[model samples]
Target: MTSRFPTRTSGPSSIASSIRRPAALGAAWAALSTFALSEPSFAQNAQPPVTELPEVTVTTTTTAKKKKAAKAAAPVAASQQAATPAASAPSAGAPAPGSRSGSLSVPTTAEATAEINRTPGAVEVVPGSAYQTSTPATTIKDALDYVPGVFVQPKWGDDSRLSIRGSGLSRNFHLRGVQLFMDGIPINTADGYGDFQEIDPTAYRYIEVFKGGNALRFGANSLGGAINFVMPTGYDSDLFGARIDVGSFGFRKAAVSSGGVSGAVDYFATVTAQETDGFRDHSDGESIRGSMNVGYRLSENVETRFYLNANNVDQRIPGSVTKSVALNSPETAAAGNLLNDYQRNIDTLRIANKTAIRIAPGTLVEVGAFNVDRHLMHPIFQWLDYRYDDYGAFARLSDESRIGGFANRLIAGVNLHNGNTDVRQYVNVRGQKGAQTVDAEDTSRNFSAYFENHFFVTPDVAVVAGTQFLHATRKREVEFGATPGETEFNLWSPKVGVLWDVTRNSQVFANVSRSAEVPSFGESVNVGPTVIPFYDIKAQRATTYEIGTRGANANFTWDLTAYRSEIKNELMCFYSAFGNCNVSNADRTVHQGLELGGGAAIAKGIIANGANPDTLWLHASYTFNDFFFDNDKDFGDNELPGAPRHYLRAELLYKHPSGVYFGPNIEWVPEAYYVDSANTLDTEAYAIWGAKIGFDNGGPITAYIEGRNLSDEAYIASASILDRANANSTLFEPGNGRAIYGGVQVKW
Candidate 1:
């Protein structure tokens, strides 16, 4: 099949008018699948968002000669990569280069950690080596369980309630505040809405969590920050690997991956498939995902990479139940869900390329573009079909040098993302389309330019400053029922901070930043009972003050941060008529919290009179949340719903030199917060226990056994939002019951 770019039309149109199609984003996808069967890597992306990537560089005349030279050296690079298995570590001086990302080669764990330490705010890097092979990391929740200040509650399947610093806490369903990325490319739609169903938690080398406005590097300007799920390259991954997992609730999963260098091209590919009957009725789901990346070296300082991704997801939503039903009969599905056979199904494909060039010493430039095509078939009270065509381009320049005899690091980037959606709605006849109800077209355009700089004031301290400019527009053309709606937003956010190097491995940092969120088409403007183009609704804005310290020494490592957000025109979801919701702006609110995480080795040598020395490790994460309205008209000083006031996750493990380990973990919520703006009702707090035993030798073979919620405690997992909730409100989602899972992996 041939892929074509979209052409601009003069006037508004309906869904039946015309639509675009894309394919051939598949041939390479097949290559990835085939490679996975022979050998595998864990860098997975949501069913590759079907996309077409346009080259973003100047073609050099020496391409032919460069290719030939690269081919000659490929064998040496491949052999060196093959020598290191999955569990090897890179040195701090010379980087163990993998594939190219941005204007530099992909770095190993140690290098990645060193790079992220430059951020003068709350940020962290979670290495895949820590969980990818040994844990059931099938979703984002599993990958981020240890990150402080971020809250992730699994709902069902790959869906979850995820938040950073109370972002999108009251606006339920699908991600709103956080920007999700795979290998530095955006997975969110043009309008900044996010979904995690396509993410394969097992397919990543590392995940970066940038809390609040620290995400300026990625052109992300939001209250919740950004998460970058980075896949490994040929040099960073095992030559080949495979794994399988099975557990209670009729759950099963299998994955395979491979990476190698042949000639000038180095590649990494992975595939995964899984299904489960689910712990609650009407919650069955299944998915298959694939990802691949190919790289070529035009020269030592200039290179380009190609990426392919695809996913197919089908999920049955159990729907929220009343609080009593959630705790008493947790397995029961809502009657309305069963009656309508509610479900969310999607198919996606994405193809893209990035080029990095070293223009001069200490100066690098990167440019890339991509296209995404996705289809969404959803059935609830009504049948909704949406076809998405999204494309974007990005460019960045980074330089490190001295100015006035002072060290300086400078970075700047710009991004443009635009898309159109073909929408058709029909009366639902139990999961099937009935008579057509409406046809429409939705278009979104977003553009952003950002820059951040660090200027060293002294040998041990630095000053940081940055700013971002954003422009967004939303247009909806309705063929029937409602009138057309078109709106636009523009914002400028600035940041300033200071960083003090307390030690070679530790730092103290603080920052003051501003952020803004423009509403998505999903949250259209409504006035009284009439739907219109717009009312007085405006973009959500916040000013945050943050301070923190993070570092490690000897056997102790810690990360702690505190922050407060004073918000204006906060966007919130309120109860609309007929079990629906609408977005509105609130007067004022305050959000303040503390995030703390630490790990230490308290003892050593417990086996056979210290004959075989071992270490006892304990890791803990704690969060304190205080979110409330600031003397509003309808709700006065009421706590905002959606999270617990106090949450903790802790684990204790015994480690040996041979990589064999065992650990017990706990998830605790001390008290429940309100579930509604009026504070009429709240959820119940509870604790769950789990354990893990694994042999992560990173040799020819490895295995693990895991158990979750072993006590089978009944509790609420997540809840919906409303203005004034009551006892009979169907807003609670029950937590999963006791379950056990085990998996074995082989690497070569």
Candidate 2:
């Protein structure tokens, strides 16, 4: 595949090529040595004993009480067994249920971490409580600030570019490549388009991240893998809670939540309202979001849950600016954005249900269904009005058994997703719809089936294999213009891996997998000159190889991974003079990276051992990215734009037994990175420093004050578009300036 646009022939001499083989080897050795030195203390601490934690009732209801009485009168042997304290404890390597104050429908944070560690692929779990205690929960970036290999930068309000392992690097608006889910229900549309506006970080109990093909179990077939946000249920949440936050740039937010359990039923709900007059021109916005769930315990071994989510978002767009302008007058809005009054407004509602049943000992069955409705009103180069209705269903079965003295596990599942969208475009009359230019109806249908098995070669070793078969179709009917089009795609993805336990809490793993992504309708919608049907565009595919190790003990924790992916038919886009993008496919490319995360307690017990607080602690996350196009027809071995080669975030903190803590943090980009595929434009390297002071005791009240960009550095946060950028290229998003924020929370 080749592009018609003019290209600049540049060799592999950019920032990505500066690292020679010797340097790579030296870095690898250094990382290995560091891991070795950090291993001893962690290994000395043993795993905690398995035991049942006490349960505390937070609320009661008459209807729930009657349901519990009816269930008690029924014959339920499985329920009886599950209720037994000794029988309820999870087996070794199994995820544990949440605490009594946690949701009964899902595993606790520690349990999720343990379960993720068992996978022979890259994955991580972040506890929600860690971010909600005393911090600004305004954006997804705030919650994932320390996750390695993930790049998150805000554009306006909740809209942001979220890329995992260089995934979705080219697309400048909305999200692709990465699949998003809430409690196992997909948040993305049936065709794999997603937005960050629907995610409520404060509503989740914990978040799970599966990188690359590790997310096959969830039917995610994309290079970026998937992220699942698990919400807390009534059985595991506080009865009442409230929070208020005020920050720089006219930011204000308030939220309230409640959760409780009564007899066999439980419920949890949260609502938040926020408004901000942003730091940059035409970047103001407001939003209101709510999330709720209710679960019923049919028996000790059977449970069902229902979820509801709603979001109303209105945000202005500042648009990108020239690099020179971004670094000089960072607050200036793009000229076109100001004239057109570009904006994005959306209203979304989602409903989902999931049920789990233990048909027999060590065997389980799960079924789920979801529906989503969304309306989008956007104005930029053109006025866009779109409506989407998406729905899907899934079923899964899993069994764990011992065969010939060896432990084995098998999982099989199927998913069906379908959606219809009404697409319309009109001339922009100062953000108002004018002369209609295009009208169409787009429909998508997707189906997938997968199976996986893990057989223990030894008590501490296992062999794993899995495969998924997918069939998808996209249909577009142009009601007011050119001919209609329909496209069909079929693919088979396979995976194989091995896991070896080095210690009770540590393991090493390796895996090879294949992933595929189909193009969404947005990719095929041509708007500028030379408009042509994109039915011939092919799906992007990649074969990835990965190796990693993860472990945690009382004093330290670490997760490190190295991966390389060879890709074909990569979905790529180039921008026109008017800022409109044309999507196409690249012949060949490579994405390789190293992800490292770790935390250690340098000093402890300064105040009292019984209180168990660290006097000094350090935590860090680092990513090294090397993404480049192979010898393509246009760009020869040039590095892909969007992400930097080396990025790091680190922090050091001091804690007192009295629940007071203070920390300093740094965000650094070590080298300039290209802003266009032609390698003609780049963003300068930068380092920013910040600090925070907070207090938390797992109690009723918590508070925090934070300062960001204390040095008031003017730097580029992100960029977009263009195949060949130059001095006049307007493709830079400026970083925020110095700011301070404070927040408080109360719970009962």
Candidate 3:
């Protein structure tokens, strides 16, 4: 297939108009050094003389009294044991004696990290506490800033583009390819579309990122794998907490939460409100979010839990502008956006339940069900109103035991998801509905079964294998059109890998896997002069080969991976003369990349040593993406449009024993990258500098001040629709200018 898109010739321009002053950098370093040397150490002050504090004395009890007390406590101990089932009990980070090797259980932070290191592919775990202090904590982008192989850039408010290993590079709207989950519950709709507005950064205890086929445990068969956000239960959370944040551009936020346990029941709840008058015109928004969960112990072998989530988001759209306008007049909004006051407003609610039962020693069974309702109101070139009802159910079984003196584990699961969308469109008369233009009903269904096993060849070596079978269907009933359309697809994906323990804290591994993605209803809709039904488009598929190593020690930690994928029938999109999008499939493409991330303590105990030593730390993440067409009929060996070839982020900070710290960071793109599939127009290479200072004593109070884009450089943060070069493309989203923000958090 050939596209009639026009091509153009252009050269890259300088992206950085200015750089940080030498005096500013010098002053920051000097201040950090001075504080590290002069501040009184909290560790020193925490020590006390043996005679300074009061002492308590215990009296010995008689044998007769002890016997009576023991008799009274026996029944209470038995009742406690009955209420806290082994299957639902809090994680202890280890299996019981004589238990099977495949038993499944929730893991604490330390245990989770260890498992991530042992996996045979790229993976990461981000602790929520790492960003809970002295940060804006506004969007998912903030939490994943330092993760390599991931590219996330904000459009306006909380809306952003998230790509993993070049996945979803052609998607200019909501997310695709990557699976999202909240507390093990699917966050994406039945057709695999997800939005960031429903995610609250403060609501998670930690996040697990499974890159590529490593996410087999969750039945995610997409190229980007999955990301799961884990929330804290009442047993692991604070009793009370509150936070307030204020910043540039009329930004303000407040949040409060409570968690507690009583008898056999535990509950956790949080509410947050936020608003911002964005940096550009027609870019203002507000949101309110609520999340809650309750858990009850049923018996010594079973437990159940329930969850609820609600969100109301109202955001104005700041449409993309021309490249020159984006660089020269960064704060200016697109004329169409200002005139029509384009906006995306949503109201959503979700409820879910999950149960766990221990059927036998070292064996567990889990089942869950969820329902979601959402309404959307949007206005741009047309007025759009959509309502969606989505629901799903899932079940999983796990067993861990020794087979013939060899440790082994097995995991199996099944998932079912279904949804229906009522879509309506009308002529836009200054952002108001004029006349009904189109009405349609879209339905989707998905069912999947997956199984994985890990067999230890030796104490230090393991072989892993998994497979998933998926059946999906999409149907669209055009009530206002002449014809309706429907499509069905079935696929089987398989994976195999090996892991070798090179040492106690390090491992080496390799894997090969296959992934497939079925097009959504939006991708099959007909528009413009092309009246051909998009149901003719085939699904995209890829086979990937990967290898990596990861490890952590007392002072240093690192993760690195390299992978290459050969893709067939890759989806590509471009603009038509009417400004509408036309989607098609490319014949062949190749995606390959290298991802690296690590951190180290450069200097320890500059002024003092021992427990609370003052240290200087350095952390860095880098990605090398090489994605292109492989001798295609139309665009032969052209580079992919969105991401750059090389991207790097690094930070250096000085810490004091008294919980004060200061840091400087940088986001650098050292090479210009193409913005069009024609390989004509491109983005300029640039570097940005930022700094932050904060005090966190691991106590009830924490505070911090942060600044970004300190040099006020103008650069493109992201882009829109893929197209051939046109002087009026309007495809650039400008990055925000210099700004400062501060916040405080308290808990008891």
Candidate 4:
């Protein structure tokens, strides 16, 4: 009745990645049994149109509404939205203001799923065709692995450690309480910290998640909330394209893209490059990225867009061991990190602009500005040189009429981030750079303003409200020591909610909120002989309670949620050193959760000749966490470590309608969780299985093959946190054992 992995340190060399796991599962079940005995051709598929619903609403017009709008067109998206199609009305070239689905500044994906179905709480819209036709999405946990209460892991190359709900359970590295965006600008760094390898998950085109406080349209007041990737415009991309990928430790990648539009202008662009040679040992990495955007049209109620981005990254650092050396040797390497050659490199550039107007016809307005230039050359344990100069601005206003006549909507926004940093330190000799110890300058400023409203009363109800107001600042200056000074904050956060619509594909919501976070600069750095230098910490607050339900028909679809939070001062770190980190504050805490995602269509004509027939799908997601501690005098109520109280993901598929799919997936963690807070170190609970085969017809051609951890399981995909530990804790990080991957894409 006692054994949470306590001995075993000699294993892990893995027969060269398990000998390509049976010729990649024998060519993925011989291409799924020769494509299930031939039968393909869907008359070049169709779908895409439906982005017009304003003029104070009221479009009905049915009588079979032009025969269900020519049987609902087609293209892009359908990897869940319960197989698309729903939420209608608005067609007839209806986009009289700077097109692109009636530009409210780029939306589409059915206006971002009708603004996350009028948000009340919890939101998500991941659909890059759900993992680009089947995984290996080069990180960000393969594009938010089924996003149910979001947790994300990957901790090497494309570095990750995302959190939402249990938001940053004790500072680990980089990232803290989420917030990152692109196309809505701001990519965290004005004291808030972020670097998820500058995100290039194949250059997005669908990704938005606004949890807690529903992120009030990006005026994000953390507690793990905002993420917006969205990119791909020239009206939804693909005028030209190319892709390539190969896998298993030594992975490779290549990419190209282009987009167009003439007269009134429009554009899109992309470029990528990659490298890998990791699976532990020094954990290799490399990257190159690019993106572009352009749009114009100054009449027809105005429009404007312009943006560019670039990045270069290189990483190497595979340190974190003990748990019996991460379950028996786990590719050893961690102890001065390869004799001090640990690394992290980056370079970046960004520029932005946005504009929109349409002051009437149900109103709209937008504005923007930005600038970023970063560079960091780290060699660990000090040999860090940094430089950053962030800047930002934004504005928004949206309105949908009918006040005394009921049905109303309004949104407001403003945000500005400011930054400056230029710090340097040396003395790592092996990774070069000897003498000099510290020199500094760090500054940050932030201002945010937000508002939201929806007033319906009935007609399927609505009553949601919002608020956010923050003003922050932090400063630092040093050359020798003692100057852990300057800090200020003015916070306010509020929210209220209610939304219903029970049928017509279900919905019901509830909310109660308030959240705030302030203290990034990795806890407002000090580096002196500290006895205190969290700059008087304080500003973590929370107050949440949520409820949820989502719907779909024609064989079912779902998304459920539940939440609870009650916190204060919760910014923890509990001690560390490999070059400082002691962080502070924690006097109460509690976070609760449950999320479920769905898809069914369990069976139907397994192969019934033509006209798109053949079905059988089941995709699932589940998450349940219960973070805690509320009664501390040095840890009393316990239970607050690093995630995993229970998590699950499931999949099963076989769908042919000529967009082939093949699946088998599972990732489970049944129990065992604790990484420290004196919960006394623990970890051991596992499940991993995978398979894939794909072909997507949203194109000129597409292909895929995948396999992972096919039972070569050695588990532990993440860990790193400490308050106390035993059995010589180095803090695990292993996972990724059996693998194979492949890809191809072309478009025109």
Residue lDDT tens for model 1, 230-327: 88886556668798998888788999999765545667899999888899998988888999888786766777888888987788889998999999
- The total number of steric clashes, by the backbone 3 Å criterion, in model 4 comes to 5
For candidate 4, lDDT tens digit of each residue in 1-748?
A: 1211111112211101121122432343243232111222111001112234332212234522443343234432244332332322112222221224533467766567656667876787776667865665778788777778898878777887788888876767778888888887878888887888888988777788888778877766789889888787775666678789888888888888887555466678998888887888888777888988887766656778888988877777787787787777777778787787777777788889898887776577898898888887777776777778888888888777666767667888888989888887788766777777878788889988988887777655679888889999888888753354778899888899987655444555777888888877666333346455656787798888777766655665677776778888888766665423467778887877677777777886778545556677787778888777778888887888888877887778776666677878889988878888879888889898988877764546677798987877887878877767777777778787888898887766
Question: Which residue segments of model 3 deviate by more than 4 Å?
Answer: 1-107, 115-118, 481-483, 525-529, 574-580
lDDT of 3 by residue, 5-48 (tens): 11111111101212122233233234323212222211210111
Give lDDT per model, in order. 0.74, 0.76, 0.72, 0.72
Question: Which model, 2 or 3, shows the larger TM-score?
Answer: 2
Error of 4 at 20 (Å): 29
lDDT (Cα, tens digit) per residue for candidate 2, span 685-713: 99999998887644467788989999999
Instruction: Tell me, by lDDT, which candidate is best.
Output: 2
- lDDT (Cα) of model 1: 0.74
Model 2: weakest 10-residue lDDT segment is 80-89
**How high a TM-score does candidate 3 get?**
0.85
Greater-lDDT candidate between 1 and 4: 1
